[model samples]
Target: MSSEKSKYIVSAEWVERQLGAPGFRVVDASWYLPAQNRNGAAEYSAGHVPGAVFFDQDVVTDRTSPLPHTVPSPEFFAAEVGKLGISESDTIVVYDGPGIFSAPRAWWLFRLMGAKNVYVMDGGLDGWKREGRPLQTDLPEPAPADFHANFNPYAVTSFEEMRGIVTTGSRQIADARSAGRFTAKEAEPRAGLRSGHMPGARNLPVGLLSTDGRFKDLASLKQAIEDAGIDLSRPVVTSCGSGVTAAIITLALHSLGHEDNTLYDGSWAEWGGRTDTPVVTGEA
Candidate 1:
């Protein structure tokens, strides 16, 4: 068994034990692209981790943004999460349907909001179900609590910051999009966006970071990053179609005990859509 550890991720057995434990809360951060045709709320309604609140990714974002799933204001996050009775003091464990995909976004959201004890449930809800863990369909009516969000501006990246990084070579860029999208061979799911990746960015496709729907162990994850030609010692900024899968990179890096990384919230949705920013079509 690999003894490697990630403070940002917890195993199903660990969460089972922590269930009903004081100061602990579980959140079903399930979400899917429109192409998937899966309703996150519907799945959560059918069955979910006991006491787990559903964190709707679509609604928990900046509604004003034209792109999808943009991070919402700290006040909005606090209020939204507070409705589920999650406070700053509570240890929040987040999970999604397919392991290691959407849950990382929720984990990153909590971290960006300055959450102290948020973790992504390793193997996610799918793995939990496969293991015969308990589930519940009834939603809990949580008494609202005050979630005082302390936003960490450094945890996220902006389009202007990405431009500076590309120009200065200050940070290594990683794209969580697939190889096709990264190579410009495949059309973007979102219309009007250009094909290709940000210049100097490495393709880390979020799916490659996992196995059997679960994230790989720390050693394998380190190898994956190294295989992408990314210098393990340098900092990384993760990007994706709309900043969703990018969190998978953030989760992987955090699992490796890496700290000098951030997620580009706008990602390619903003960068590729704009004609001003330089984009490269081809492999790194």
Candidate 2:
């Protein structure tokens, strides 16, 4: 693995330089867990990177599903991104307050919609604030653009497909939840959900992939995956509490040049809630 930084992530200073440049878009994809007690939208309203548009995780989701923040249809996603004045060709940079957390979901969404030139802002908005970069409270007057979304279903895995993987072990399953939650030693943040991992799943907590709100170098990221007993040569399915942090694993795997990977959108929120799903209560 190499220490290439340009493929998957960009620094705060680099984002500042591209602020007013043409065909470049900055998106604030901040989202918080319920326990964090913080409102991502409210924080974005207070202040964000200049010319940055807010991408609400809750709003940019499939409302038809009972699960929280499910991925929306390609048509709906295109309309919402178009309203944000983002064209498919533009360079999109996504960031959250905490680096490599919720922002990758937006990055993943852009890729799933067949939009390229997307990168996650390393160190996130917290690094921007620490560097004393310009922050604006006033919203930009967005001019709607033609964002034709071409969705690729291969980037995501359905529940039925995931169930098949669990039974057959055809692909590697990576759980991005904390060690305690993954091992069923601690309770889940969501109520009424079982605390354990899928059968034959590998535990790769999000912490190992990043540090101090920034992702590690490529070699380190690869080593972390290898230490978790995952083979990059095999296919992978990443899952988290509700499919948000799952992208962190997907991002790391993609950064490592492993393209045969898909995210489990239903994640544990759907898996643990059902009584029919077989969940193991210890390490894989």
Best by TM-score: 2
Per-residue alpha-carbon lDDT of candidate 2 for residues 64-116, written as tens digits (9 for 90 to 100):
99898888999999999999999888999999998889999999999999889
Clashes of 2: 0
Worst 10 residues of 1 by lDDT: 1-10
Residue-level lDDT tens digits of model 1 in 155-196: 889878999999998999989999999999999998999999
Give the clashing pairs for model 1.
Answer: none
Q: What are the RMSD figures for all models against the true structure?
A: 1.4, 0.9
Which stretches of candidate 2 lie above 4 Å from their native place?
A: none
lDDT, residue 20, model 1: 91
User: Total clashing residue pairs per candidate?
Assistant: 0, 0
